[model samples]
Target: MRILLVGEYSRLHNSLKEGLEALQHEVTIIGTGDNFKKYPVDYCIFPKYFLQNRILILLNKILFRIFKLDLQLAEKGIRFWLFLPKLKNYDVVQLINSNAIETYPFFSKYLLKKLFNQNKKSFLLVCGEDTPIIDFMLKDQLKYSILTPYLNDSNLKSEYWFSLKYVQKNYRDLFNFISLNVSQLIVSDLDYKIPLPEKILIPNPVNTNKISFDNLVISEKIIIFIGINKSSYIKKGTHFFEKALAIIAQKYSDKIEIISVENIPYNEYINLYNKAHILLDQLYSYDQGYNALEAMAKGKVVFTGAETEFIDYYNLTEKVCINAIPDVDYLVRELSLLIENPEEIIAMGKRARLFIKKEHDYINIAQKYMDVWNRN
Candidate 1:
């Protein structure tokens, strides 16, 4: 199959491309290399004018504050307009998000129309919570979501201005247009599934070949690692994890070592946590995200979302991953339990690696995509 995957955010499409190629399928990816992470792509559409140049970058801030205009958006508009003709003649085209080009609805809708006309089959991936998904989250459909902090705390609402505004009538129109035009809508995780009940559910692909399982050795002192992305700190419930970590650090100062790194590049980020015993991932997801799954593939104990839906899907009573919650007390207790019982940590790490190898191996995920694409 000649598949064209559009947009890259979290190395999701890059890993999927690797899997498809392994299965002898022709796959092409067009993306911005996800900023500093720099994932591979056949076509790079990163708008470089204002963001890369120092003087223009400084001026962009001024433009945003005074005229309420974004230079970065303008760059994307120009680049995507020029790149539209190249986005044709693929057997299948998959969008990373509704606003894959990071432009206004007017432009995105215009582009989607062209995409629909050009491609044989076009699908949308409900990767992150989009406009409609954000609307559903605001309605509290799930037991808990990343939006929980914004809904419960007024102070945190400011941090999510984009999401709140995106769900409004104007922004949602773009998503509506894409939904009507796309051949199918597929979700990579449960967070998107709650809002989109009818959409196909496919687990995110993990490149297990790149990640090797090592039997975690729990020594006298345990190393706990938490990597923070400043953009999604509040949304990912980082404060809750930090508060819980604070108490754990004070209580077991000698037995535990906490490592906190913020907004580093992808390669350095992974290597930074390589020697760690535990990885604390997002607190608001209903399924394991890219980071958690990758850590699990490396045989690390990851504290992430493993809700009932995820548990039931895998059909295992054994706890391969720790369900991270928003409550500080609950998080503290869970960390304490793991700290006290070192042996369980090693056992859980092994189970977590096996789970990733079985459920998220990229080759199997690629076959699932192929099956969906071939279906009438």
Candidate 2:
């Protein structure tokens, strides 16, 4: 199968591409930059046409009106549409939503579906909450995949500008919203309870192999948090993580080591994970994102709980990490428990690594995608 995967998240590119190739499928991950020399891949540098000035905006409007330019979206909107043919040639197009950028592209996608003629179908893989999914599906029977869906709370300020109109008129429109146009909804956690009729539980695209479980030693006293975005704190309770860690460090004195892998490359970041005892995944988001997976692959205990749905699906109650809310007191108690039972922590650490390897190991993720493509 020729799968044209579109997105810029590092996890999506590394794991999904590697997974697909292992299955002997032609996976071409189209990205925004040309820095893919380290990996065998193709880079599609779509020009950014963000309008900054009124004069240029006016000029672009005139050019668009005269057919001098193709303004399907803002400007790059037209450029993305140029790849509409690529989507047609491929068996599936998993549209990964990065930081809510899917809003701007919907205009191009809607226009292209109308203007372009295609033989094959391309599916939109929403990062869980793309308001436009309701619009595109309702306005024109389109449905997409919800990979790692957020809880059914759309109050956060994404590209939708927090509008309820973005939701379809009724539940009848929701029928198409489930699949938009894809076969199955690729999900990382079974914790999502939004009534997905065609939900396919899959591993999040995490390259667990890159990190080694053998490298984690109990002598390491470091406590680590790897968040790439501060905005994650607002939703995932970054402050809570910080406060909890503060209490542990204060109580343990020099015994507790804490580090935040915010801005760094993979090698440097993984080194911190190697030198750490615990990994703090988000408390706000119910399911762990790629960071937690990475830490787990390193045989580190991730301090976050899976949603009830995910827990029930896996029959998972324990054997790995401790699940807790953002309450500093709860986190402090969990840390104390781990510190007291160092052996248990190590046992859970090993279990966490095995969990990631058996579940989200990039190879299985790729195979899952293939299954989705083949309707299995």
Candidate 3:
């Protein structure tokens, strides 16, 4: 079947496209131009630079005040017709609606409704609880696809209300709309009162193609976690890992080296992972991020989160990646053990790799998508 995927945030479409094509299905990916690199498939480009879309939207808002034109409505009106011809042509089209301000086209409920009405058979793929218009656009859907983890699942959601203040009210309203409209909700198995169309637990997809653990020669070196940014502590557990590192590094300073090249470009990172024997994933959030998964693929043992659900998902009671707070004392003890027993560490790393291959390997996950699409 010919499929068109729209939006390119989180690089998910690329992974999905790669997986589907491997499954012998035709997939076409489209996204904003200029920001993307050479992807596996030539994606659709809706050209809008930072200055162009933001400035245009702001100008329209100013115009709204002068002419009393429902500027938001007016812009939505123009884009609906402008984009419909291109959008309505797909057999299955996935709209990647982001919560960011720039995703105006994806946010237009009326446009999506019109397109869906025009073509009733198109399988609408909506990801995350983002977009203020999801419920309105997909109010009749008997199901939902929720990818992002629960808002309160991590400690970071304490700022959710504050973050909501910046988004336009209508946009924020969409979260509740999705809650009301969805018949089934797809999400991680976390303890949260998220309203669901029906609760479906689908863990995040792990890309095993980029990750590997075939032939690893252990090196006596410590590698700081990659893919961690300023928010790593809050979202991916940067601080927690760092604190544990402080404890672990005290005795192993001469034996194990720690380096955090979080800002390294994508390709270079894998090479670094190849060199390191261990990867510190996250101290705060859920177990093994995509970064942790990548490290495991490179044959690095990760020491990070082990949330109750994640522990159950993998049945990992003996934390290979010791999940502990920044208590230097605790992390130091855990690291000492790993550095002392390299074989055990490698064994755990192998387990990590196996878990990723069995669960997140995008190829298998993509096949699952096809199976879902071609159901009885």
Candidate 4:
């Protein structure tokens, strides 16, 4: 099958491409490398000059402020329009999200219509923030979600603009357009799945072959690592992790080492966390994200979302990873348990690797995607 995956998210599409190619399918990915993480893509529409040049970037910001025009998004749209001919004629085309091209809603709709018309099948992946998920949150459907912090404190409104924008008329219209064009909607994880209950749920793919599991050896201090993306700091509930870490530092200064980093490239981020015994991931997730899954595949005990729903879905789980919440006390307690019982850390790390192999193996996940695409 000839597959065209539009946009990249936390290396999900790249890993899926690898698996599909291994199964003798031709796959092409076009995206902006997901910002600073820099995930690879076959056709990159990244606004390099606009993003890299200081003057241009300043001008772009000023233009947005004055005229509500984003130069970078415009550049991306133009680039994607130029690449439309080559992007067509695929057996299947899957969008990473509603705003896969990261352009204005009207421009995105226009470009997507062209791609959808040319492709044999069109599917939308609900892996991140979109109109439906935002709507679900706004209605207070979930017990708690990524929007919890923002709901509690309206002062964080600025931080949530990206997500809140999905509730606006323009974005809602874009969502309706995509929904009408696409064959079906697919979700990547429980976070997205919970909101869009009717959509097909497919777990994120992880290339276990590339990520080798190393048995954790903790002879002295238990190192804890956390990587933060400034843009998502509030949405991801990173402050809760920070507060928990601070308390852990004071109590277990001699027993543990805390490493915190912000806004680093994907490769560097992974390499830096390799030595740590524990990796602190996002708090608002109900299932593991790409970062946590990759770390789990590497036999590192990760503090991430392993909620009851996730555990029940995977059944007979022996603590594959820690379930992180927004409470600082809970986080500190979980950390203390792991620190006090280092053997469980090694045990959980082993379980985490096995869990990834069983539940998120790239080849298996890719095959699942193929089945869904073919069935619909």
Task: Estimate, for each residue in 1-376, the C-alpha lDDT of model 4 and write its tens digit.
Answer: 9999999968999999999999999999999998898999999999987899999999999998999888999988988998998987899999999999999899999999889888899999998899999998877766678898888899989989999999999999999999999899999999988888888899999999999788999999999999999999987889999999999999998999988999988999989999999999998889999999999999999988889999998895489999998899999999999999999999999999999999999999999999999999
**Ten contiguous residues minimizing lDDT sum, candidate 3:** 141-150
Residues 186-297, candidate 3, lDDT per residue (tens digit)?
A: 3422321122334444444666765555644556464444346553335344565676677666766777777676554455656666767777665543444445555665
* Model 1 whole-model lDDT (C-alpha atoms): 0.86
Where does candidate 4 clash, by residue pair? none
Ranking by TM-score: 4, 1, 2, 3
TM-score of 2: 0.73
How many Å off is the CA of 285 in candidate 1? 1.8
Evaluated at residue 52, the lDDT of candidate 4 is 96
* lDDT accuracy of residue 150 in candidate 3: 21
lDDT for position 103 in model 3: 38
How much does candidate 1 score in TM-score? 0.96
Per-candidate clashes come to 0, 8, 13, 0
TM-score, model 3 to reference: 0.68
True lDDT of residue 318, candidate 1: 97
- lDDT by residue (tens digit), candidate 1, 182-251: 7788999877886888888889999989887788987568999999998889888898999999999999
Best by TM-score: 4
lDDT for model 2 comes to: 0.57
Model 1 is weakest, by summed lDDT over 10 consecutive residues, at 162-171
Q: In model 3, which regions exceed 4 Å deviation? A: 32-41, 44-48, 51-84, 95-107, 114-168, 176-185, 188-197, 207-210, 231-233, 314-329, 374-376
lDDT of 2 by residue, 208-291 (tens): 656656745667464555444443445456677788877888888766667775645555566666767777776644456666
The predictions' CA RMSDs to the true structure, in order, are 1.5, 7.1, 7.2, 1.0
